[model samples]
Every structure is written in C-alpha cells, then in structure tokens.
Target: MGNKPLALTALSVALGLIAGCAANSSTTSKAAPADSGEKAAATAKISPNKPKNDYNITVNYELGMHCTGFDFTYCCVLPPYNSVQSQVIKTATGPKKYPELLEADEEDHSVVVDDDAGKRFKLSYGFVDNTYSEGSKLAYWNVPYDVDGDGKYEKNENVANAYWTHLYVYEGLKGANPKGTSKDSEKLFVGLQIPVPLDNGPAGAAVPSPMKGGHLHYSGEKGTIVYTKSPVLDNVPIVLTNPGIWDALGLPLTPFDDSLVRTNPLTLTEDLVRPFQETFVSLVDADSGKPVIDSHSGKPITFVGTSPIDVPNCSRCHSNETANGKKYTLYKQERA
Candidate 1:
C-alpha cells in the first residue's frame, strides 16, 4: 500500500480539533522536553487503568508482536485460553453456562514481561479489535471513567474522548526505532493508538502506515509532550499467495530489535492523519521514525508493552449486555 496524504481540507479540520483538545486535556504523565527516555521508565512503574479520578487514563497500544497473534502470519487466530471467545465456548460446553451474551476480553490480551538482564517491560493494555462487537465496528476500548461518581458509567468515559487532540498523551519511546534500532535502547517510548472511529463503510479500511509529515504527541507518566520522529515505511513485499506462510526466499531474514542499524529521519507533512498511519495497530516511532517492527520476525511491529495499572472488570461492568439469552458476565470473579 502507498502512503497517501489526507485531503488538505480534511486535515485542516482534524488538526484544528486535535489542537483544541490537546490544549484543554490534562495527563498524569506529562512529557518532559529532552527527557522522554527517563520519563518512560518512570511511567512504566505506574499501573494501568489507574483510579479514574487520578485525572488520567493509561492503556497500552498493541503493535504487531514477533511471530505472534495478529501479526501478518497469525492474523485473526484467537487463542484457545483466556480469550473472550474461549470463555463463551467454555460457558456453552460447561454446566455453568451463561444463557446470554458474554462481555469477554478481546484476542491477544496484554501482559507484562521481564526480559533477561532485569529489564521489565509492562504491556497490560491493547486496542479493542472489531471482533468484540457484532457487525464490524472498529473501536478500541477506552480507559473507563465513572464520570458522575454514582458508580454507573457512560461509554464515552474511556480514552475515546482524547482522539485527535494535541493533549492526548501517548506513551512515548525515547529512542524509538520502528526498524528495530534506537539511540537509547534502555528508555524507549511508544505512542498511544487513539481510538478514533474510521468510517470506511462497506469495504474495510486499511490500517494506518506512517510516512513523511506525520507527527503525534507522546507523553510519559510525567506527561511531557514531544514531537514524534518520522516513521520508517515497510519496504518488503508481503507474499500472500500461500496465506499464513512466510516466503523464505522472497524476504530478508527477520532482524532482532537490537541488531538493526539506525536510518535517517524522513521529512514529514503537517497532515494530522499522518500519525494515524500504521502497519496493523502499531504507532509511528518518535526516534527511528519508523513503524515498530518485531525483533525476531522483522515484520512491522505494533507497539507491544504494558504498564502495571489495574483496570476494572470489563465483564462485570458490561454485565447488562446479554447474549444467547444469558448475562455476559462470564469472567471469573477473582480475575475480575
């Protein structure tokens, strides 16, 4: 797919909205100029879905992982365990079945990782895939907020409110490398994927692919704002004839994230939609100016990392929605 620029008129309107929102909103983790790297580590120390009144919402934006679920090869393959689908199926097969619909965790849920050398990677949240809802609505789950404090909720309380605003602070990487290389590997930043509803209607829309002139704001737990680096465009051709099988001869050996060298940044446009360009759900990197790629598979990687933040039980919260004549609260109480 080619990187097409958004219409000037459309972009102008979007930018105006983005600027207005960014200006008014406040983030807990405000970004610090020239200190994004340090702030990222600190940001990781906090929890995901922190208490709603903390005046901030934090969730992980998933990028394609190395040879894992929803990556080009593993696209749409749901795991049999801990997934919303499996739970539904289990409920049906087991004696303790929910007669109605179940509010389940979408495929490929987030987790925290501790790599060798004591490096902790917190990946607790992800974008909501379209599968969660019936009839093809592409919206990610937002950070839920009990706006009125009556304990009840409105759908709009989550991160969906921050889309297109300059104030919406995405998790940022200090030396972000979409191509698997970075200047500061220790403190990396990631941009949060804003859950903006794209109305592609009829035919499905393509995922955003970052190119020149794309810029988005990133913040850490400190809420420091920083301009994102240009994204590295994917050059390798994806061979889909055999679907699900990688063509060894057609592609280069997948490079490890630490092995790739840094490349020059691309000249970007003022198009606000440029930040929305992505390979799958991955955000454009601020340091390497490329879409984050998987280290082992070498495919364009969507941002995959988590925070320690604790969130509410979606199943419990969405219990009102019934399915197949039963309530959808099938999640185990302990986990919820």
Candidate 2:
C-alpha cells in the first residue's frame, strides 16, 4: 500500500507546523554586525494580556505486533488488528508557559483542560472518517462466510456480528450481545474449513494455517465471552452484555462516548485500507457547547492530525530465496 509515503507526508506536515508555530510565537532578534564585537540586542518582549492557547494531538498504535502479511495460511496468520490510542495536550502562551493534560469527562460527555491562568475550557476528540456506526453493513472481507443457515452466504450487515467474528477468528476470544436473538444480537458464523498447505520455503515445511470453525461459549463471567470448541462449552445459555463486546473491540462502551468523541483505544483497520487516520481536536465552551474561536484566526481553535501505520514485512528479507533466486538461511553464522 501507499502507507509509507502517506506517513512521511504527514510527518513532514507536522514538522512544518511546529516550525511555523515556533517562529510566530518566539521573539525575533536582529542580526549582529560582523565589524563590531557587540551581540545583537534583544527586543522588548510583547506579552499578551491573556494567555493564548494552542493544542496538539498525538495518536499511536497500542501494539507493534500488527499482522501485515497477506498470506493467511502462515503460522503467524493474523488478520490486520490495528488499534490506536490518542492524547491531547493544551499549552498556554504567556509570561509563564503552562502545558496541561486534557481529561475526558464522562459526566458532561466532554474533555476538559485548564490553562496556566486557571481558565478552564472544554475540548473534543474524534476520527475524521472510516468509522462505522451501529448496524452498518461491514465489508465482505470482514465476514466472508455464511452466518445464517441460508444456502447463500449471509450478508454481514450488523457491526456487532462483525465484531464477534473478528474476536473469535483473530483474537481467539468469544463475544455475545446482551440483546436477545434479535437482528442486532446475532453473531457471524464461520463455516468449518480445512487448511491448504504451501511449500514456498526450503525443505517443504508445512506452513501455519488459519484457525476456523470456533464458536463463542460463555465462560461464566458476567461481561466476558470465551472461545470454545468442545461440545460441553457449546451453547451454554448466558446473558451477554452488548457493552462487553463493544469494549473488547476498542469501541466506546457508553452512548456518551461515541466515535465523535472517542478518547482512547480508537481502533482502525490495519490492512492499508485507511492506514492514515485523521484526528481532530477542538476547543469548546463548556456551557454553550460551541467551539471556542481564536482571536488571531477568527475561527475555532482546532488541531488536525494524522496517525499513520507502517507494518514491516518480515518475509521480504527473511525468506528462503530472494527475488533473484538466491538461497538464504534463517540464521547466518557470524564471523569473529
């Protein structure tokens, strides 16, 4: 995918913003004359009457072990499981600079941060795109097998079902929705399938195949789903909380924190579908719930940032043979 170039571009843009902001905020001094030994005199600092605030958003992946290879039959066969976390920093510009950490307010359903001058302001964080709402039809690849007993493959239309499939297949975890056997509570069913062996490496060793045909059975936990294959663990009737499934998928557990204001564990697809996810942070007025405008820009004070993922391909350099048909060993003997 073109993720590398996109990540590089995003980095360049961030660096440019930092440089531009530093230039605008710092006091500039005139160049010193070469003939004289005197240094350039510092100009009088002009401080703002009130502290000017600026914000930055940092997003990063939760784990580095992201499955990037397309070969699903390999031993490390894992689907793209990319999850991201985000943090917001608020900085106030004044005689005494203040950097504050913003926190999510579950009660008010907003993020609050205090400036150096003790002025409190509300903020919000969210992804710009590539998010699915509840009950939205997922992509075919997300649930490629028939879920219902119908002859044809069941259409994967429910987000909750897709989430269950993802957990069972990729994470080896089971999930169930608290809602009864309704359309929204059903889980995706992956039909039993065998592994296809491949001998791409030397000595024709059997490669790892994808896991399939597992079902979710309750583990007796209140809000947990466990994967099971034994008949004893199968179909154990239990109440499953919808919030548990959502929480496992790195989704917001409460209605107050939807995609529009998800603070942490913002999950995204790692299949290069949308490797670069854009995030936005904006200052808001707590009482009015409106955006706080910047005096200089005459617009809402906001920061737009992009989180990029670059999964390294291990097979490229560690394979048995190179593209030029050269033999390679898994371990090379080091010379003293």
Candidate 3:
C-alpha cells in the first residue's frame, strides 16, 4: 500500500531565535500577549510556528495503494484535471455524480466545470459524502492553489495573505506531562505539510504512532496543528447545490454503499478517511534549509484530535451496495 502521515514534527533549532526572546524553562507559558507581534514571538517558544525547514511532508491516498494516489482499488487515480461527469449520474443520487471533474473530457466525465480542481496538486484524498474513505488522489476540485503568480504551485506562506485552518482535538493531562526538552505539537500539522524543511529536527519530528489502533493525537492529544493548506487551506464553504463537494464527501454517486458508516467520536474514524498518515506527500522548495514552522509568513496554528463520525446511510440508488459496488468496490471508509 502507501505510506501514511504521522504527527511527530519538530524543528532542529530552538525557538529562542523565532520567539524573539529567551527559552525560560522556569517561566510557565502564560496567555499570549494581546499584541499579534508578541503573540507570534511567544508562539515559537512553547507552541509551534510557521515552518522554516521541511519535515518531509508526504501524503498518499487510496486505501492500501500499492503505490500512490489510488490503485486498482477505489477508483484509478482519477485522471489528472478530469472532472467527474454529471449526466451519466441518471441512476445516482446524493452527492457526486459518478465522477464529476474526473475525466479529462468534460463530455466524457459529464461535468459542466472546467479543469478538475485537484489536477495540479494531486491531493491524497477528498472529504465529501461519496468517497470519504476512497483515499486515492484527493479530488481538490475546488481547492484553489495558484498562489505565487509565478505560474507554479503555491503553499500558504507563498501568498501575500493566506488564511490558516486551525484544528482542535481535546486531551486533558496526557499532553501536560513533558519529560524532555522536545517541542510541542503545535507545529505537527505544519511539519506534516512541510516535512522537507523540518526533517532535521529533534526526533525527526516523527509521527509517534503509525497504526490503525487509536487516533493520531486523540482526546489526550491536545491542541496541535495537524493539517494546513495555502491561501484558504481547506475551509471551503459547503454548498449543497454543488455536487462536487458532495462527491468529495463520499456521495456514492452510483449505486454505492448503503451500510451504516462507522462514525464514532474519534477524529480519524469520525468520517470516512483514506488513512492520511499512510499517504506520501511531496514538498515544494526543499534543500534550502527552509523551516517547517516559520513565523516570518505563517501564524501560530492549532490542531486537535477527535473521533470519527458514524457513516451516513445514503446511497446513489438508495440501496445497500458497498463502495464501488457492482463496479469495483473499495475497502476504504463508506461515507453516504
């Protein structure tokens, strides 16, 4: 299959430089100063900051993909720039119509949109109602990434004003006990995104757990950035009229799964997941020694862990047919 992502990101150098202050072990971290500048500085101390180095950010979708994106499983790594068709969805219902913005040919894919949004970046997975667990290449049909204006890919920091997406998963004392001089988990998500820059950090900013047993940073995992994107990241508003996002949420456009989606209180399992930790993501500008948690451009972000939501019982044909159904069927999470 593919390699999953973990949350053990850290920086090689101490935060004293970025903190704009000293590392005072005796001084307990207090509420950040009201001033944004002061807050940014303190964020570097105990909390995670924008990355200056790469943590070898990597993500691969497609459950048990022998390689990257998707494989014979789920749906063949949706052709790059191809939008899922809509007309062929006569028999389908709910979100996603077969594969909107999926095929290169708009007529073939049967979509009214232009190039597929996930074409350039080649995401690891989508989070709509259909293919929630179809972790192949994230179908970022609407995720805007053209940031630098250099006619190239753009990371959040690359933009003049990039919005940060903060994730929070609560954990009580489990995260309070720190025995070593290691860094906090705030930058974990940033590191996960920018692995290349932060790879040289302590403990290699490793992902503590790489299993399917528990949450990555479950209830005891506290506030730590787990994932982030450039510009607006993944804070796209959901428009029910728009079926693209519906498809992204595992809509089961065709006669898809009708079983009760397992949505517990766990973050990973809360919804259909393609095993983000197992994906292989690529870094942008690495080898230049750029840090993963850089305050120069990014702000202090937060990410918390939670439980997976129970899978919804809504299929295309409105019947119980597993994922991919009579077509292929995937072992990933079945959302709707």
Choose the strongest candidate by lDDT.
Answer: 2
TM-score top scorer = 2
For model 1 the TM-score comes to 0.17
Q: TM per model?
A: 0.17, 0.37, 0.18
4-41 per-residue lDDT for model 2 (tens digits): 12124455345335424543434666767878898777
lDDT of 3 by residue, 59-168 (tens): 11122223344455564332111111111101111122111211113222111111322221111222223232222222232234443245765443321111212311
**Residue-level lDDT for 130 in candidate 1:** 15
Runs in model 1 lying further than 4 Å from the true structure = 1-216, 220-290, 304-336
Model 2 scores what on Cα lDDT?
Answer: 0.36
Positional deviation of 312 in candidate 1, in angstroms? Answer: 12
Better of 2 and 3 by TM-score: 2
- Angstrom error at residue 212, model 3: 6.5
Candidate 3's TM-score? 0.18
Clashing pairs in 2: none
lDDT score of residue 46 within candidate 1: 29
**How does model 3 fare in lDDT?**
0.23
Full ranking by TM-score: 2, 3, 1
> Each prediction's Cα lDDT score?
0.23, 0.36, 0.23
Instruction: Give candidate 2's TM-score.
Output: 0.37
